[model samples]
Target: MFDESVSKKIHVPLVLSMFIGLLTILINFFYSVEDIRSEVYSSQSKELRAAYVNGLREKKVIALTNVINLSSNYSIIESLKSQDRNVAIAGLQTLSRKFKEQTIYKNIKVHLHDANLRSFLRTWDVEKYGEELAGFRKTLRDVKKNKKAIATIELGRAGLLVRGIAPIENDGVYLGSVEFMQGFNSIVKNLRKNREYETAFLMKEDYLSVATALSSSPKIKEFVLAVKEKNVDKDFLNSLKGVEIEDTKNFQISDEYFLVSEPIKDFSNVIVGYALIGEKTSMVETVIAKAKSSLLKQVYIIFFIDIIILIYLIIIVRKKIIRPIVDMEKMAQELSL
Candidate 1:
């Protein structure tokens, strides 16, 4: 009874120590899980950035290709040669309708400039013409000056646009340039549909005076949620009130959301806006949950078996060695007496 009592006393302290050890392990395990989640998000952000940039490049090429082809149309050429406004308007109206029906490039605006880089015609707004474009129309000026085609992402009175300007030459004499332009809406829409990324184009307040397309959409602080921007919910968009794109590579709006913002620049290397890409953390959360559950289960089972083995070894030592020593000490005391 005394030996059994002694064994129970030893086990009490051992069990307490084991419990403290287990608690420490659990704290470390959770911290490691958090680190794993951070690594996964960091890796995925690079991929998201790559995909977004690639999509932009492809769109630029497509816009430039369409403009070059349109510049070669026989009727457009004839109208340019004769400087006939009425024929040019009719021809462009017909072409615009055909463009709408035949391509994803609906409502593509075609603007014609004279040799002096003066705005001669605007197909989208027939009445808004004769504006002298020598000051800000660099793309038009480049094509006319070099007698070659040029395309770029430019900011104008209309807004930020993918514009392609091609020189019109009849018998080695440069007549003018034809500029074809399109917006960023389709590009954003495609990224959302294909990559499961919620994207928003946040335009600078300075551009609001010139970028008319962004003026009416939605405002979040000083920046405007451009017409090209897309988010799944209005509340999610509202949550972006103070998102600063400079110096921040990625940010978290909530425990379950991760966002990365990249700057959007114009042809002159001026920062025009930002492209904010966001994604949910469902997959990362699932991985963490599974890892935590498995770790706890394994630790508990191992500790339980370890404790049982430790107790058995202690009992054996007491029976085989400790009891003998105690008995000999008592016998010596009796002999001495």
Candidate 2:
């Protein structure tokens, strides 16, 4: 009976203690993994944003330089200020033909506006975009009002565009502004081909304005294709809504992905859209598995040592304390008899 009681007491407490210790270790290990994952994601996000912004800035600078060079010419300025549509049209055509071979003017769309914000000419084949005033209006206003150059990444009718505007001035007289825009497909193309990562330009409502992924993986290709306007999953949209500039978070579509979103701002500093750069979870999953395995290994070692200690205590107590008391009781009973 004494032995039975000793077994019940020691075994129950030993099992409970082991369970508690294992639970604690598991909790701690998971917390550590989360912290490490967040740190890794954040560090990588900053690097990606910096690279993307640098590329974008370079493109904007090129466009601004071209606009400045073309618009600053005395001939272009005189044509713009002539107040005659025919002269403006003829001069613009001559300038276009003259510089058609220049690499800087290639693939660029130009718009010239007068001082009252009236349209003078556009390189497009249309007769007019109407006097309604289109394109990056704020940038036009800044260039016209301040008589200086301005540039920004803005959402346009066709797609996301990098725009540059500079005042058409001759001898400190501001005739109007010359605005130039180039589609950002080249930027996205460079990112997809040069950097082996997926890139997306998402407007409001999870609309994928443009998306591309590295061709190295067929899975990534499929993933990017499915990430169109209508195919965005609800969970992913909800998760994406909360992402801010330079903030990194985990999201899921076909599978888990870590995404860092940077806001695409206009000249007025408004968040017109977002640029999402992401990597598949498979890469980080491998890291997390290794970390957890290492943590569990430590837990196993500690648990083994604890079990040995518990067993040793049980044996010591039964022999030095419980067994001795029972033996003394028997001796006393025999002497009394």
Candidate 3:
């Protein structure tokens, strides 16, 4: 009798153990599948971001080159080379006004280096920020020396500007420099007008905030400044670290972020800047929420099927196995008694 009771107790536990083991196996399988799905989704998101950034950079370069080519026309250069300041200024104003009207440029300005081709045209605001113009002067000197048709220049507080310097040669003498200024704002506005993504910024080698589409809200400005201070290079490095496409691994700025960056090249295909695109974490979170909702529905359906299968298996075990074992136990008990 004692042996029979012991066997029944062990039998109950063995059945429970088998049920638990089966449940564990199913749970692990589902968990692993979920992990894999998340990983694949993250990777795809990264690739998409990188592609978008590179495309924007390429577009900017093309647009800039076209603008440079237009600015380099001999007629435009000759008008600026005229010895009369009034004629040169009038010509420049007319060209600037016409270019602004026809093209997507904003605040277009022209500078001419003087008859000596040494001192460049000084804007009214130059005196206020004389220190800032030094780098621009240096860049102008370099462009003149190298005779580069298109180039990127850093103009301290004026921000980074794309310049097209076309030398005007009247007779055999080099007359002056015809410098075209396209503010970084134009690029920012262009991107904003065309692209749907938020947080687009252009960064130079020094990580200066050339132009940003960030909101005018103080909070946003503060956040941007914080980002600039903390990880300017780190952020830029993360974007261009890879061979072609660099996707930062779902970094969170304030929330979850999807970011991609690509180097900006000039007409000569030299990297001069970087274009960065960022999507807010909230957007991804919304996607995840929707996915979870769908997943839950699937999970519920699978769970229902699992429950039905478990119930069927339990019924079969009870009828074919447990009942017979119970009958054997009952017979042995009767014999012992």
Whose lDDT is greatest here?
A: 1
TM-score of 3: 0.53
Per-model TM against the reference: 0.73, 0.57, 0.53
Best candidate (score: TM-score): 1
Off by over 4 Å in 1: 1-32, 228-232, 254-256, 283-337
Number of the candidate with higher lDDT, 1 or 2: 1
C-alpha displacement of 69 in model 3, angstroms?
A: 2.9
Which regions of candidate 3 deviate over 4 angstroms?
1-63, 80-82, 114-138, 164-177, 186-250, 255-280, 304-337
lDDT of each: 0.74, 0.64, 0.50
- Give the per-residue lDDT of model 2 (tens digit) for 1-337: 7657766776678778877987887788778778866665565566567767877888889888878887866656777767655665676666677667765454457777887777777767438833645343667777777887877765555445788888887667778888777765555556657764456655443223332222221121112222233333334444444445233343332345556666777666876566676555576566667766776788789878877887787788778877887787778889999
Candidates ranked, most accurate by lDDT first = 1, 2, 3
210 Cα displacement, candidate 1 (Å): 1.8
The local distance difference test score of model 1 is 0.74
Question: How do the residues 1-337 of candidate 3 rate in per-residue lDDT, one tens digit apiece?
Answer: 6545655675566667656766775686578567755764576467546555554455447545654664455555554555445554555566668767997654565565643444444432323211223333665565556654544544333444555565555565666556655544434444435543433334343433433432221121212221122223333324323312322344323334455545555444555454555555566556666666666676667667766776676667667876788788889989999
Output the lDDT of residue 59, model 1.
70
